[model samples]
Target chain A: MGIPVTIENPKPEAEAGLNDLVALVADGMARVNTTILSRTGSEVAMIPEVANHLIASGGKRLRPILTLACAQLCGYADAEGRDGDVKLAASVEFMHTATLLHDDVVDESDMRRGRVAARIKWGNEASVLVGDFLLGQAFRMMVEVGSLRALDILSAAATVIAEGEVMQLTNAKNLETDEAAYLAVIRGKTAELFAAACEVGPVLAGRGEAEQAAARAYGMGLGIAFQLIDDVLDYGGTSAELGKNVGDDFREGKITLPIVLAHRRGTAEERAFWQRTLQRGEIEDGDLETALAILRRHGALEETMARAEGYGAEARAALDAFPDGPVKAALLGAVEFCVARAH
Target chain B: MGIPVTIENPKPEAEAGLNDLVALVADGMARVNTTILSRTGSEVAMIPEVANHLIASGGKRLRPILTLACAQLCGYADAEGRDGDVKLAASVEFMHTATLLHDDVVDESDMRRGRVAARIKWGNEASVLVGDFLLGQAFRMMVEVGSLRALDILSAAATVIAEGEVMQLTNAKNLETDEAAYLAVIRGKTAELFAAACEVGPVLAGRGEAEQAAARAYGMGLGIAFQLIDDVLDYGGTSAELGKNVGDDFREGKITLPIVLAHRRGTAEERAFWQRTLQRGEIEDGDLETALAILRRHGALEETMARAEGYGAEARAALDAFPDGPVKAALLGAVEFCVARAH
Candidate 1:
């Protein structure tokens, strides 16, 4: 389905585990990073520059944090044998960083998260190549974990991620793109990594195939929900609320779900607004208001939120296979908050 | 020391070990290809379109060839450990294919080995992500080999190659590039995989540090020489000789050693031509002829060949440290051809 089905929101009390996951993500970032940065390059001149820029660029570190929470919930609660956990998290981060560098190059974008992108600051060539450097380094980190299963999971996720990126490229500026195709693209581009992160945790904990698969499913649903929310925020939230410029995607000729739904369900006049603003790449001041109005008139925004909520519900369902525990609760909370977060 | 001093040319002859190495590479390709294709993607619809284009446009498979050669000369001459040798060869091929995909994207070139470039066929997004897919697949293949040292070698080489590519991006059309800087670039961009290829052989063969290092030294020197001869071929040979246009580098404004030395050692009148054609990127019809003449007149071409000879000599010296064997002689012959091949 292009749009996700609607699901009831979970209890607010579920937020407890989500907060813990966030803090766990922060700790994982500091711990895995020291080793990762040191392993980057032995050469003195370029190593620090590369590491500093990479470290300074703050991210949610969502994948690593998920990994920690999954491992904890699966009953590997202590830091003992956490090397594999840390390394997998680092691997996810490396993949994330690499994609960022390459994404900026492909988009020819200069700015990301309020900082000049690596492609712009260091030059496109460096950004592209350094992205590659980190990808290889990530593999090196994972190999020491000594699990073929882990390698297979991460590698397959990577393939999906790249394929997702291509799917996005193909889908760009095409108003006819339905919600099904859009979700497929996101599955590859974003959800795959999340799935890999959570899956790797149970895998490292030496769980059975069923549990590993369950964790993986949980991650996949959560990652999709997270990205869906991100897309929704691009339209619904303000700059201060979402910490990004609103209406930026429509301006860049990108076709998010809100546009997809509104274009299909709106009146002829509403459809024309999308065609002019998106297909023609013309976004004037006050166009955001017009676009938001069309979305509201067609009930597309609510529909989009419903889709994300469905994924969040599916993500929570994946955790039902695991036993009752704080970690499981935390992971479940993460899914709810991921879709519900305005920012 | 910017340009390597010419080492004495030895009339190298073929050995059986080298022939076996060739067989090993060819066989490795045949065997691992099933996994490579399947791993790239499972969609039957997309397979013939995305993966086939690059795979069919075959270069010499030189990277893997280097790995087989490394294994043999490093004393893995016994056919007993064929899988290890083949896996390494396949791993190197994976890395090379990945780079080729990425390079085509960054350069935005249309022609590769007289066929439409992969990016041109699949589009930039497919090209980029497929490249990422191949890189991820490469790590998977390396994991299959089950050696941490092999993983380290390939991973380190991958990073260096990326860094080298970035360095080249930085140096594009900048005539200020010197011989040492040029050498460093080549080492990263071209020589790294070669060095790793050769080193892995000894490591796989269960050799000690000295032998592995010797194989590595040989591979690195031979790769540099191979690149030097390629640059020379770009200037002195025809399209048929080099597999594509002879002067494609000049057209794309790449300042290789031929131009690097000409820029440094040419007359004032000649300097203007270098500045305009290579540095200024205002190359025209007559510039190719004029640039060729300047290379000849200043003896830059001869000197460039002399550098190739020097690297070739070092490549041979690495072999002398090895005990007498058929594989050793074959490795020697390959290095000789690397520097002396007509193309």
Candidate 2:
């Protein structure tokens, strides 16, 4: 052998775990997909066209699945056939979809979910307006559910998510960003929404505060782990795995944990390279490859994944309060699957 | 005089009526303004900066004033000092401000309320995010008031507003956009918010459905009138009076009633002129003057104002069910003031 390089293989168990969670929520998810499709319709044809471009392009409805699974775990049966959980789950997805649309526009992203972004197909104007349309529809659904507590959690999450995006904007291309700052940004943007999505389920079921808190904690940990894994994948993963360009974070100068660790553990010359490529946005032909090499040499990706594993462990622990049922196992497995995606 | 042109002078009574309404809602307006300022704060500096750039640059607070006036008219005394109307008024203003920020970005506007737009100063990303932040905060405040009805009304209005905006985008630069389509667009974008704002006041007061309907009717009529006057002023009003650059709508080839009326009534030659200037977006120097001359020749501006007057009459009639009081008179006067702004 020339070099005997170590290879990390994809975990079948991780994929199976995700599938189990999906299967567990299949019935509710079907209704959610239907609700989403029907609600995106408007007299203005462009609204639905733009919305469906992203919604129809599959992104793995992880957040809504979490909402539904959490609701079921909390003993929600819809005895009166209110279907509040279904509506709330749909609302969660809408909020997530709205943020994705706006994020694509903000990042000037070209592809999302392995297809041309809505912003690219329809102009940025349509992307922005349709994103607002989805967000408005999300709140309307929440109001229909008639739960002020759910509204409070989701709306506050929306505010924090916006703040996180703004913070990310400010941190973009800034090589001095530290790990704490990186965690703060991701917590606000990513984890907050996950927490809200999970918490709203228990609120809908009228579960006790302990159950809601457990679900919220689990989601928060899972989300942090999810984002960390995503950041690592942006460097180490393949385009097929990501369903988008692999080096988008690097190309966009998006500051993330991997970049932060790499910058911190780098030499003076490497730091200067990052400043030139990211801060000043000057990239040569080999800049991406060079960046990857630096990250590899510093073991930044592995270290980031380590942090993700830590969060995943916390997520698994958070579900300990629930009875040992298939739903709980699936939720815990979600945390494992999220972390193992890096392999 | 060479032509003995008819002159329309500004009405002092109309101005006085607006001032009277403003004075009546002064106490609540102050609280609303304070709430707006405080709620815009975030740890991310860019959010408050972008938000304040619009909020402090003061567009007339007519929407919130209507909310307050309508609440007072419905016999809402805030007996327990809940200040639901105050919070609701602030929320209305926030929604309005969020729409304005997004609208400026969608239109790619350079100036708003006599100040440089937030998008221009901070870039479109920040503007869009800040707008979302404000909208999230709007719903949070509505939720805090514990009124699902208010949330329903406002959320529905937001969805309609987004649809209207999309419709308007589709109609832009299209000479085939007729009066009915134009009316639908404006009613969705502008009138829906006004109607919801007025209706929420009654909802907060726990008034009867008829009172809520009447308030909504008044708001819808006034909003249509207000938009018509704004359209008329785009070509005829002064820059100082409009607080923005005149001819922006023409420069953007935005389809409005005046353009529709002028195009519908124009000869073949005039239609070609409009097609070149508006439909093709090939505006040249002196094109605005030519457009104004064409509007005057067809009496489009006057006819538009006459239509606004008719809506103003309907708005006044909507207030007929309420008892005669300073608040009711002030609300009616506010309608007259909106229509009179064209002069």
Candidate 3:
């Protein structure tokens, strides 16, 4: 009933190591999944019914997978390590789900992942309530993790993400956007989770503080790279893969990185087009095409790619502290995959 | 500028004890308050400005006081005893504040304690973001409490509180709001915090399981009683003293204790009124008075008061485990105050 993140694209050939790592995650995820999804166990009709609808919408569990992968890669023992690795992984996913639920409500987005959003299906009240339910579920999962350090990281990440959202709102349609600001927003909103997901693994693994920091950094960098690519894909990705109406950002008057770069390099004529349109928070026909042309002319799309590459490199560097193993290698590939994925 | 709870009621009497606690909480809250009341320290400019208005609102530290009082009554030591008490108490306030910030957003409330609500001031996006910030700050503060048990209790409470919010939203206005069902919601939303406050005290005091559970029970029962009183006051209390808009709950289409009781006992004619006004999800002119009269006629208001009294008695029973001392007496007074307060 809610906006579930659907992946319509055919599964890419996950690198061999990544595939194996995901198989391990799938097991843990199934175990944690039951508890995370049960928002209302009450006999009350409205609650359990509406709750069931929201939970029934499947999610990709990207954040959880990153957590499980990072923990396994960092050599947190599946056999001997703490239970937190799985719970924390679930916690991250819960946090992610809560945010998405709230995001749909805030954006007033009617559909997500090719289905009517929860807000639309159940009403804004249900959407907001379910969002709160997911949040509570996240904290419940965190309590099971029993690591204050992990709680601190995840909670802090949530705060930062919220701030990022606010920042995004205030920046809507103001065309003087730049790379630095865009990156900052991305890091706060998107990267913080990516960072938290990866970082929590090290902490849960009982890895030393240094390794934990390293993992955190890796997640942070990868998250930024991932978000940047997402911004680009919003402009370029097909409807089937993106599960979004193309040019949603432009239509919503969001000033993303490509637009920021193009705006930076605009000629007087191009500048006039945006100043009269985008900066004023208005859109005209073919505005999306014109914006794409500006990005191409300024080589802004390529610059955006270059920035993603930079973050990917940084993410890789952050993982250097991990022990050399298949899991580590898999984590490395995942970062690459994070940036390189088509959708 | 947003409505401020701070301006609504400044606790001059509790200020000394609370200040000692505030001195401890001020730094973390200041940071969280800044981040919460402000934007993400990124590109967007309006978030922080909006946040500032909401954070400055007046609110009493009743929850924290209960936490500190519980600890003091249990003869808790900071490791350093009193100093520890202050920190722990402040942690309670921080958590409560964090929840408040988040609650306003979830509820889409436009006012708090006679001030413009945070969401209205900052928009839903910033309010939500700041609320997240406050939650994170709360965990950070708890971490400073330095006990795994403290983290566990607080985390569980956080989850329950969120769940309570969900329950409240789900349970809104259908008129099936039975006493048992209503208690569950109140426990999740209100009692959990009160219970956490008391339990955290004993944990800090290095008390045994029996004492901790007893203290937690005391807080939980008190919270329920307190909420019952709140519902009662909503119908009867003057807006001048309560600092809340009268009939706002009805306007929000909520089905609380009085209405539930009235629905059960009212005449067929009254049932028609209830169905049309409450279940119909709209309160028309003079409906508040009519509803109040129905409640009185059916003894619904008195029944609610009696239920609150029963919980208050139960709250006192939970404290029987504690010693006979001034701290214990204060804790008792606080419980009484929770239900007995005019505003």
Tens-digit per-residue lDDT, A222-315, candidate 3: 8888888778776776666666776777677778898888887789899888776667756877777777777777877677868888998998
Which candidate should be chosen as best, given TM-score against the real structure? 2
What would the per-residue lDDT of candidate 1 be over residues A1-343, giving only the tens digit for each residue? 0122222233364445477777655665677777667766644245346545755667666787887777766766445654777788888888888887777766667667656666666666566677787887788787777777888788777777877777777778889899898888889889999999989888887899899989989998998888887887777655543435666677777888888888888788887888888888787877877777777778877877788899989998989899886677667778867876742
Better of 2 and 3 by lDDT: 2
Model 1 Cα lDDT, one tens digit per residue, B1-343: 0122222222233233344556645655575565555555644244336766777666767777777666756556546554777777777887888888788877778877767887787776566677787787677667776777888888878878887887777678888899988888899989888999888988888888998889889989988998887788777655543456666778778888988998898778887877788778897766777767778777777788889999989989988888876667667768766776632
Q: Model 3 in CAPRI terms: which quality?
A: acceptable
Number of clashing pairs per prediction, in order: 7, 0, 18
Which prediction has more favorable lDDT, 1 or 2?
Answer: 2
Listed models, DockQ each: 0.45, 0.86, 0.43
* Candidate with more favorable, higher TM-score: 2 or 3: 2
**What's the TM-score of every candidate structure?**
0.87, 0.97, 0.87
Candidate 2's C-alpha runs over 4 A off are: A1-10, B1-10
Clash list (residue pairs), candidate 1: A2-A179, A2-A180, A4-A307, A17-A330, B17-B326, B17-B327, B71-B201
Whose DockQ is greatest here? 2
Worst 10 contiguous positions by lDDT, candidate 2 chain A: A1-10
Per-residue C-alpha lDDT of model 2 across residues B1-343, encoded as one tens digit per residue? 0111232334787788799999999999999999999999998999999999999988789999999999999988888887899989999999999999889889999888878889999999998999999999999999998889899999999999999999999999999999999999999999999999999988888998899999999999999999998888777666655667668899899999999999999999999999999989998988888888898999999999999999899999999979999999899889989999777
